[model samples]
Target: MAVHPGDSPVHVALRTSDVDEARAFCRKMFYGPLQVNPVGDPAGFAFAGDVVTLGSITVGEISYGADVRVNIADLETAYHVLAPLNGSLWSRHRGTVVIADPTRAAVYRPVGDIDLEWPGDTRLLSVKVERAALERELDAALDQQIVSPLLLGESFDLAEGRGRTWSALVRLLHTELCAEEGLASSPRMAARWRDMVVSGLALTVEHPYGDEPAGLQGPRRPRTVKRTLDAMHAEPWRQFTAADLAAVAGVGVRVLQEAFRQHVGVSPLAYLRRLRLDGVHAELSRSDPWQVNVSEVAYRWGFTHLGRFAGAYRARFGVSPSQTLRERR
Candidate 1:
């Protein structure tokens, strides 16, 4: 259903009878390049869309007045969710098919080929999140490096529990953003709202880490683990070997490794790499793109191999180092 014009401030509004114009608007505002074809009579085609953008997130209410088929080769740089407010949607992605209705939302990952069938009666509340932004939020919440692709389940439940909560939050965010002087008008508040939405999705959707217990406290750190962590945090720029960290903890390498495994989820070197990556991210976030180089920053954070570092960085943050550097603040 289209948002009432006077009720919410729409960043992009479309009410057109031309299919090409509707397709072009969808390309510009949401997905990149895609194809839209009417399933029935072309002469009966009508499209209505109302959208609001909040930083890396875009939420929209959209509908096609006639049945249509949409094909997208790949989303490329974002994750999308389509929750129908009424009627149903048929979607196929990565060999999986889902019929999405009000209780079920179709989730599309960045890497897949997608095909969708939209009946004339359906209207959708759609959410789009930039790949990097969502990945970064997942990393912070899990306190570890996330694997690439971050594969998500084809369908998300919106009838109860966390999924229902997240769905409500998305609608609230859309409404607030649509207001001319809502809470999201402030940059800081807007960021918090964006984080809440992404974080909610990450927690609600099924993924590789879905089974991990939430808020489970790890074992308390003993003195040796604490000492080693202090040393690493103090000089993350230092090129440290396992033996060196063991020496700093006043324990043998084997003993230190076991302690790290017990108290920390990762090994010592892995922890060091995480620390270094965090340092690089902080520097890139504050450094001016014109005055800084991503490689130099990587080196400064003790990332000796450029290729491996870039891969790890993208795996953890879901974007290239240069992209992060350029989009600083």
Candidate 2:
């Protein structure tokens, strides 16, 4: 789990000491029931001075990855960044995630399970931060009032991997915490680490170069795009169209399309569809299924076209919407 605030982001350095204790801790941390059967004994140990970690295989209920599990404390925000200096690890963020390796890295939000497994051994860093910590750190660095549980994106720059100071700092901190002593007092270390980290992140925020999406107005937009996004967010169940979006955004159809395309990367319709699909799928997968059935949930989310909705849901989440229903029992 990755945390932000300078002193409070939970930075834990765990050593593979007692396998039983480690497994139990993993179950508690990663949000999974204790495995009935252990997968591997980490055949051999690696003497990597960086930080060595024992690996395991995940079986049974596979919501995401089998290897790693995380359980977060309330008022705490967790972020997991796997720079996989090792071989490769499977990652699931929103839908069906891809495998990340040393050559590349991926980041997960405050919520979500992360996994890593290989035949032999592996090592990676897990970060956890209390919400207050992340908020205070980011606010101090950015000089802006930032809200808690602020969602740091899962996106990263591969071409610029390990090139920037921010990226390097993460590696250094995670690596150093790999010792028994390091993990024993990770919070203390993390506080200092968060201090340095917030400084770097603040520097990036000030520079505001290639960090966020292109054409990002950074608290500003073409008014039309802003209005359109607000409306869609307000009522996802409405019949939305380009003209409708244009009207709400206070612009013509062409301008609406251009503004959305420029600021948001996708066209208005595509963006709306993405939003609706994300909402509906999230309702299905993450929300309490007891409150609604598949079809009813779909309708509530404005998915009149069942086939189209199912297809989009499957494409995004790697499973059918009904699967969520089936698993409810």
Tell me the TM-score of model 2.
Answer: 0.64
Over 1-329, each residue of candidate 1 has an lDDT whose tens digit, in order, gives: 23222323347789999998999999988876789999968877889998887777889999998999999876768989999989999998755789999999999887657899999999999899889877776666553445445667788899988888999999888877867788865666777777789888887777643344133344345789879888887788899999999999999999999987766657899888977876786677567898989999999889889999999987765667887676543
RMSD of 1: 9.2
- lDDT against the true structure, each candidate: 0.80, 0.51
lDDT, residue 294, model 2: 86
TM-score of each candidate structure, all chains considered together: 0.64, 0.64
The global Cα lDDT (0 to 1) of model 1 is 0.80
In model 1, where do residues sit more than 4 Å from their true spots?
A: 1-10, 212-329
Residue-level lDDT tens digits of model 2 in 62-142: 112123333222212444445554556556554446565655555554434344343233444333333454445554433
Find the 10 residues in a row with the least total lDDT in model 2.
54-63
